[model samples]
Target: MSKVRWKPGNLIYPLPAALVSCRSKTHGDNLITIAWTGTICTNPPMCYISIRPDRYSYDIINESKEFVINLTTTQMARGTDWCGVKSGRDYDKFKECGFTKGEAEVVDVPLVNESPLAIECKVVEIKELGSHHMFIANVVSATVDDKYLDDTGAFNLNQSDLICYSHREYRKLGQKIGHFGYAVKKLKKKPRRKKIN
Candidate 1:
């Protein structure tokens, strides 16, 4: 098959649309919907979120050095898009979006109570990358909504109807075909019973 080529740019799609909440003494709490966010490490538990320096939430996060990453769901699609479009300078996102501010355990910032998962992060470093500044942080704490927990106490995140950002569009997570290692795992064969003549 032939393919057409385009100029180099960020082609990665279907990224997690997280609402990052930040607060400081000078500035009140604010939520910024971030699509440029992901886990950087697993051992020490680290993540990063890239935001435009001009964003109101950027200063609050820089001053506080902490933020909570709240996972978005299909129910929060409107609020997520709204928060990203509107500036915190004019609107109180939490109140406007009808979201409750739930206190985080390790960070001073509050999390979105409606979210199924909230990850509290403390900034360790900041990289000014042209258009956006990447905040590299260590995960201080992570809280999950009990409603998303299965009977075995395992997190059923897929059932949460999580939403993602793809090419400026918000989409819900689709069907799950397999687990982490299913592709490489061997299938067990059933033992055949001897026929009695």
Candidate 2:
């Protein structure tokens, strides 16, 4: 196969379409659907979300310095798209999207009740980039929906219909590709049965 070169751009596809919730003294509570979000570090538990400077939630986040990243599912596709398009400056996204504001354990910001998981973050620093400003944050708290927690206390995120964003469309997370370290890890060998035969 041959490869074609295109113009320079950030072409990383399949990003989590997280619902970022925040609150400010003046703005109250709001939601902003963000695809430009991901985990940055794991040791101290860090993550980030990038937003345009002109976005309505940008100032609110600046004032609050905290936000909740609510993981979205295929069931939440409609609300996710709507929140991304509408502005907090004009509409109350939570109310419009019919999303319940769940209380976060650590952060002042509220989380999406319908989300299977919520990552509460506190702003550590803000890097002003060209079109978008990145909010580098330390993960303060993470709450998973009780429904996703099994009897054994294992979180079955695979059972939840999680989704991702690619290009301009939201897509469901299909079949399990592989587990972490599956490449180098040893595979179990099947037991031999000969005496019984």
Candidate 3:
């Protein structure tokens, strides 16, 4: 096999494709498609989203200190891509993309009701890094569609059909290969054989 080295750039693929909703008093509501977002901490439930300062949502989120992260699905690929390219200053992305906005539990920012999963976040801190600023937010509340719940009251996120963004393309997630500790965790031990004679 042959390999070639490439320049240092964004090589990480398969990031969650999310429509981040933020609002301002003047602009009312807006949505920005984001791929640079992920969970930073689990204990206090923290996450971070990186965005350029010039983006429309940047100012809104900075001023309001809150936003909703709406998980995207395969069905929303087109809308997600469109929102990323189009600026909120020119158009009402939520209305144009046929997405419904519902009141967020923690913040005034509206959540995308069309999304199967919506996470309401409150900005805890901000870090300015070169081109993009990172908004470190503590997840305030989350709302998921009841239909995604299993009979045992377990949330089945996979059934919601999540989507991912790689480079500049949108892709749907595939089947689950294994659980958290499937590789190392021991399975049920077989019953020991009874003593012979």
Candidate 4:
């Protein structure tokens, strides 16, 4: 089969559509639905979200240096889309979208109580990349819904109906095909039965 060539672009789709909440010490809170966000580091537990400087939430984040990344789910698709299209400058997103504004564990930003998981982050660095500025933040604390926890008290995020963004549409995550390193890692097994003959 032949394929048509296209210009180079950031066409990477199927990304998590997170609702990033931020608040200033003076102003009220706001939520910005961000699709340009992802995990950036491990040791420091960092992540990054790219935002246009003109966006209303940009100033709040720039001044506060902290925000809460609320993981959205299929149930929150309507609110997620609303948060992205509407301007926080005029609308109270939390109230208008019917989402609860809960207190954050580590940052001044408010977290969405309805979200299954919320990660509080503090900005560590900022890089101006043309049209958008990437804010690299370190995860200060993570709060997960108790209902999603397993019997062992471990958080099971996979069980949540997580939503992702692809080509301007929201998509729910699907089944897991494999675990980390399952493709090439040697599997542990019961010691080979020793022949006693």
User: Quick one: best TM-score, which candidate?
Assistant: 1
Clash counts for the predictions, in order:
0, 0, 0, 0
Give the RMSD in angstroms, all C-alphas superposed, for model 1.
Answer: 0.8
Higher TM-score: candidate 2 or 4? 2
Assess candidate 3 and give its lDDT.
Answer: 0.91
The lDDT of model 1 is 0.95
Question: Which residue pairs collide, candidate 2?
Answer: none
> For residues 1-197, what per-residue lDDT tens digits would candidate 2 score against the true structure?
99999999988999999999999999999999999999999989999999998999999999999999999998889999999999998998988999999999999999899999999999999999999999999999999988988899999987889999998889999998999999999879999978974
Q: Measured by TM-score, how close is model 3 to the native structure?
A: 0.94
**How many clashing residue pairs, candidate 2?**
0
Model 1 stretches with alpha carbons more than 4 Å out? none
Which candidate has the top score in lDDT? 1
Q: Rate the local accuracy (lDDT) of all candidates.
A: 0.95, 0.94, 0.91, 0.93
Better of 1 and 4 by lDDT: 1
Which residue window of length 10 is worst by lDDT in model 2? 188-197
Ten consecutive residues with minimal summed lDDT in candidate 1? 148-157
Model 3 CA lDDT for position 78: 90
As a TM-score, model 4 comes out at 0.92
TM-score, every prediction: 0.98, 0.95, 0.94, 0.92
**Model 3: per-residue lDDT, tens digit, 7-109?**
9988899899999999888667999999999999999999999999999999999988989999988888899889999999899998899988898888888
